[model samples]
Target: MNKETNYQKALHCYIQASLNILNHFRSSVKEIHHIGSTSIEHMDLPGEVDVLLLVKDEGDLSKLADHVRGVGYDEVEDFSTGYIEEVVLRHRYDGYDVNFIMMHHKSKRKDEILYCRNRLQGSEKYLERFRQLKAAYQNEHINGDEYQVKKSDLFSSVMNMQGDADVV
Candidate 1:
């Protein structure tokens, strides 16, 4: 199948899975958000859709996991933090893979979120540099292995320039 068709199918499956989970815990979940590459527009061959289901209390997590299993999703594993528990689910449909990650409200990492948002919204120069590197890698204009090495250096340089390393 063509790339576009594949992406559309993946998106459909993601939305369905998300809705299923949401309906299962409509009363307990405070919010459900679609994050990561799949949520970004024009992204082709995305690894997988990352869904964050935020609940108000940690005790509600087990109920959410049970609800997901009841909806035909196999429970892959559980990830825990001091304030929340994340239940991971994986299922396949028509050779496509879908993943669901249910997290509690307290699990939200504010620092990481803010850092990523800042990087994406930073100065034009940084954005342009990132775009160029991305285009090179996407267009196969450079060796993948070489790009990986250079990309790390690019990130380090950008971080240093922004003094992000000093930020707590």
Candidate 2:
């Protein structure tokens, strides 16, 4: 009777999927993380699961993409950056937004990714503030693209505030 059951279930499956992706590119990817709304504890979240794939060299990205596609995750063109080439994959697992953010190990952008989440999750006040914003946005009944635009604006600002000098 838990309404959050599906969220938890999907998150569990998504984390497992992230582990599988890490296994697929274990040689290149040293550390893989599950970070995002779903990664936040006690936070109401959607079905999207953002994954961080930290590469050791980031030299052979094509091979990694090929291997990712070979594992049934079709590459979706999203999250392309100047330094980091993000290769998000789409799988038919009940419409889960599984993002594969490929970045160099110990890169600034990589650190930023975790830092953004950690900062919000670190403080209950901030977390509740963000949760309220999310609820307000949802109440507005906006489309997904619009919702993403708003979230992107917020997250981009947060990351920018976290010292935009070195982003992995």
Candidate 3:
């Protein structure tokens, strides 16, 4: 399939997954967001959809995961950073990946949802810098070695901007 078709398929999977979660666990989840590269338009395939599942409490995280799995998503792995539980799921039909991150109401880590949204709303200079870096990296304007260096720098700059926000 073409890149556009693949992206649409992935997006459909994301919508389905979000609806499924909301239908089953609406009370526990405070917010469900579609984040990461796929959330940004005109970007190449990032191969997965990153979801941020914010909840009022962390005690019901396992229940949430079970509900997601019950809806035909297979759990691939789980990660915990003392503040949140990150549950990775892969859809059986399309193999599209989704991350169900369970975050407590109180956490110091930068909020992924706010970070992504803020970055997108950042100044034109910041956006232009990112665009130039992305284009150069994608088009092989810079060699492989230079691409890695430049990519890291670009990412750090974006992260720094996002980090300035209050996470709550």
Top of the candidates by lDDT? 2
Candidate with more favorable, higher lDDT: 1 or 2: 2
With candidate 2 superimposed using the best TM-score fit, by how many Å does residue 168's alpha carbon deviate from the native?
Answer: 13
Query: Considering summed lDDT, which 10 consecutive residues are worst modelled in model 3?
Result: 77-86
Predictions ranked by lDDT, top down? 2, 3, 1
Clashes of 1: 0
Can you give the TM-score per candidate against the true fold? 0.57, 0.74, 0.61
Which stretches in model 3 have alpha-carbon errors above 4 Å?
1-9, 44-46, 78-85, 92-95, 110-113, 120-154, 162-168
Per-residue lDDT tens digits for candidate 1, residues 1-168, read: 545653475667678866776666778788766543354344444445656667777887787777767868787643222213457776675454566666667664533433443554454675566557756876789876766666666655655565454332
| Candidate 3 all-Cα RMSD | 5.7
Per-residue CA lDDT of candidate 3, range 8-123, in tens?
A: 76677678878877887889887777665566554545456766677767776677768777878777643223223455555533576676655654544436445644575454
Q: Arrange candidates, best TM-score first.
A: 2, 3, 1
What is the per-residue lDDT of model 2 for residues 1-168, given as tens digits with 9 covering 90 to 100?
656564586677677777676666677777888776777776765646777777777675667777778878877664433333565666655466677766677677777778878776665666775676566665776665666676666676665554344333
49, model 3: CA deviation in Å? Answer: 1.4
C-alpha RMSD (angstroms) for model 1: 6.8
Clashes of each: 0, 5, 0
Model 1 TM-score relative to the real fold? 0.57
